[model samples]
Target: MAVLIGLAAALAGPGGTAHAAVPDSPAVTYTNPVAEQRADPHIFKHTDGYYYFTATVPEYDRIVLRRATTIQGLSTAPETTIWTKHAAGVMGAHIWAPEIHFIDGKWYVYFAAGSTSDVWAIRMYVLEGTGANPLTATWTEKGQIRTTWESFSLDATTFVVNGVRYLAWAQRNPSEDNNTSVFIAKLANPWTISGTPAELSRPTLSWETVGYKVNEGPALIQHGGKVFLTYSASATDANYCLGMLTASATADLTNPASWTKSQSPVFRSSAATSQYGPGHNSFTTSEDGRSDILVYHDRGYKDITGDPLNDPNRRTRVQKVYWKADGTPDFGIPVADGVTPKRFSSYNFADRFVRHWEYRARIEANVSPLADSQFRVVTGLAGGGTVSLESANLPGYYLRHKNFEVWLEKNDGTTAFASDASFHQRAGLADAAGVSYESVNYPGRYLRHYDYLLYVQTPGTATDRADATFHAQ
Candidate 1:
């Protein structure tokens, strides 16, 4: 890997500068086990139109890296270990969060781990790769990494500003206890810290103080001339939260006083949405440079039950990154089941809309029906007579809501244009013991009844066919 470290260093340019033709919205693709049995995922979009994702897999026994053309592929794509733990002492074992980055024409991977004999000695380290193709590169184990922590450190991120390179990560100050804090320092190279580490931010905010005295995993992003230092807070349990510290590009980034930490969290666990402990996120820009996405992992349940290690949740998740009017993140609530956002897709473009196909919809209704009127189209889609659009497996269920839409798909291979129209208003979403509606099993949104998601009143992409249903590879 040392021979090709130059290939990883090339990441200093943000993946070749030529972006893919991404839409105004970046698509959020997910891989449930994003390299299953892994934790603390760190991803990088390479200049090769594919994303390279790596995580800490205690069971894998090696540093694993996976690449895919699309975001969703990362979960299922075949993975290769660019490097593995060697002897004891320097670059021994217990590898975690091995992130490959390109800077100054070299390929370098940043990770945390303990020596073969000392598990608590986990610290940041780098591997020098010497090839353009990361998998083929010869990875040489580098020496011990210097970070903000004089003692323990991990989750290191590096970025360049004003022709100068900076490194940020979670650490434990010598004066402080073992609790990790976010800090920044000047970098001499991918493996060297040039200057003393400065305190950038801490888990001081309410959300930051959610679990134990936590705060670590800093991913630095400079967008719209604003330096956003995003980090994870709390334990890996339900208390986990995502926090941000923002400042102008001209400000002293190495100084802690220059940044202002947001009191509220930018992202957090949504028990209702079945996404909990959403943190340790990295930002990815779409091919068109318009879409920004935050990718992380979460659990379906909130509480840490009998065993923390055996929990089945903690699956990787992907979502669009939104900005508020105040120039900050506006990650509204997670899209609960059966609800989708309509504004961005439908209203943004007149004819462009979301559609679903080859899906099953079934619902059962009573004489004293759930609602006075049956379910009907709300906006874009409309059936003049014996529905020209082919639909299968719909039973006696009324899909009506005061404010809702549907995304109908035809039996034919192609999808139909988006349609929306109000349905008979009555008690619908209010009841959680929902009717026996045939819908896909989605954590956030569902195909309630024969309910097709329409254009108007839709909330987010959760209502889009991509979110409600799945596609075959």
Candidate 2:
């Protein structure tokens, strides 16, 4: 299951508009989920400015890792087989999605495996890295981790909160209702349990109880003074979805009741999207600190006619995650491949793309009554785009396309030569030698002006000016 091509990026112009536009961006969204060829995909950001993606490949008893300089790069990056199962026992059989975690002073890789007698006898194992650099160093098998006293346990994650370390995982609890459930406990070490586990919740919701009432693949995230626990729900089919638990940062995290579960699944396949079994997700931030991406695996079709176990369309996919007004995570509705994204700006002036600047427009408007420095013409944009202005002290926003001289027109139809203050001219068109106007930016270039990115500001003292110029750093 490969993802259909729909590429996008976020950029800023030297002129500081909140967002830079990317070309071929679909202004609207339509959901079209993907097929699954990968299972339980995990993403990690490495120190070398690359992201490494790993997932379960049931056919091959080996740990395969893919790396790329960018999140988009990982999807098409060259994959490397870092480790493989060699025997039929303890650490050699049924090697599942192995996750690499760098902690304390070493690298620890965790996974689930078992002996030849039974694949269901899956337990957790860890491998340690001994050299200074993991990519070029050797990883020594540190052996199976001592987990809970249960025979069934996998999909484990280690996280720290409020200075205390903890581990969460899914397991088969005979003492509980259906035997399969989710739980968490404090870790004695990287592999040992320190205290009694708490039953977070049962697979009762419609999303979680989709097939045989299974809940697994728990991942943790922290944001906006709250900690979020996200889990995979249902069987590995179209019925698969994502369920979440949220708790405030000040709450007693050890208590399962302190966490509140979402009434519905956070992520699931809709009819618009032909893909199914969309679960087992991880979250990572972008290099620019402006994006939070959702990493998950999807299957292209709906019905698993034959055997679901042998189905091979589970491939990995990723998309940007948005946030709600309250600062909580909002996994925006997923869209189909090839859907155009909103244009984004990439005006990083340090790279010398263009000189752009933004500021309040100092208006001497006699045609209409307006305050001084109440208008702005954010310039240095290349093609067709939009420019906005507002009363800094008032709560209103104004927007118009850049192709026309909206700012200049609104400011009593005047264009002043920026290079010289000697002449004040009338504005008729933007492309004229002394006449300047904003235009939409192409995909590759960003609006750049000034020593820093420009944005509109409020009216100031009578002498304050609403103009900016670009200067090389």
Candidate with best TM-score: 1
For each candidate in turn, give its C-alpha RMSD to the true structure in angstroms.
14.8, 13.8
Residues 1-473, candidate 2, lDDT per residue (tens digit)?
11111222233222322221221211122122222366778878767677767788857488777777776666567677767886666656777767766677776677888667777777878777765445555878777666556467778777888877787888888766663677888877776777788878678877788666877888888877899988888888888888899998788777888999998888887555354677788777665545666778877678887767678677777766544446567664343443212211221211121111132222121211111122222321221233333221121222222322122222222232121111112121211211212223222111212222232222131111112112110
User: What TM-score does candidate 1 get on C-alpha atoms?
Assistant: 0.68
> What lDDT is reached at residue 324 by model 2?
47
What lDDT score is found at residue 109 in candidate 2? 72
Q: Candidate 1 — which residues are off by over 4 angstroms?
A: 1-35, 306-313, 333-473
Q: Estimate the lDDT of model 1.
A: 0.56
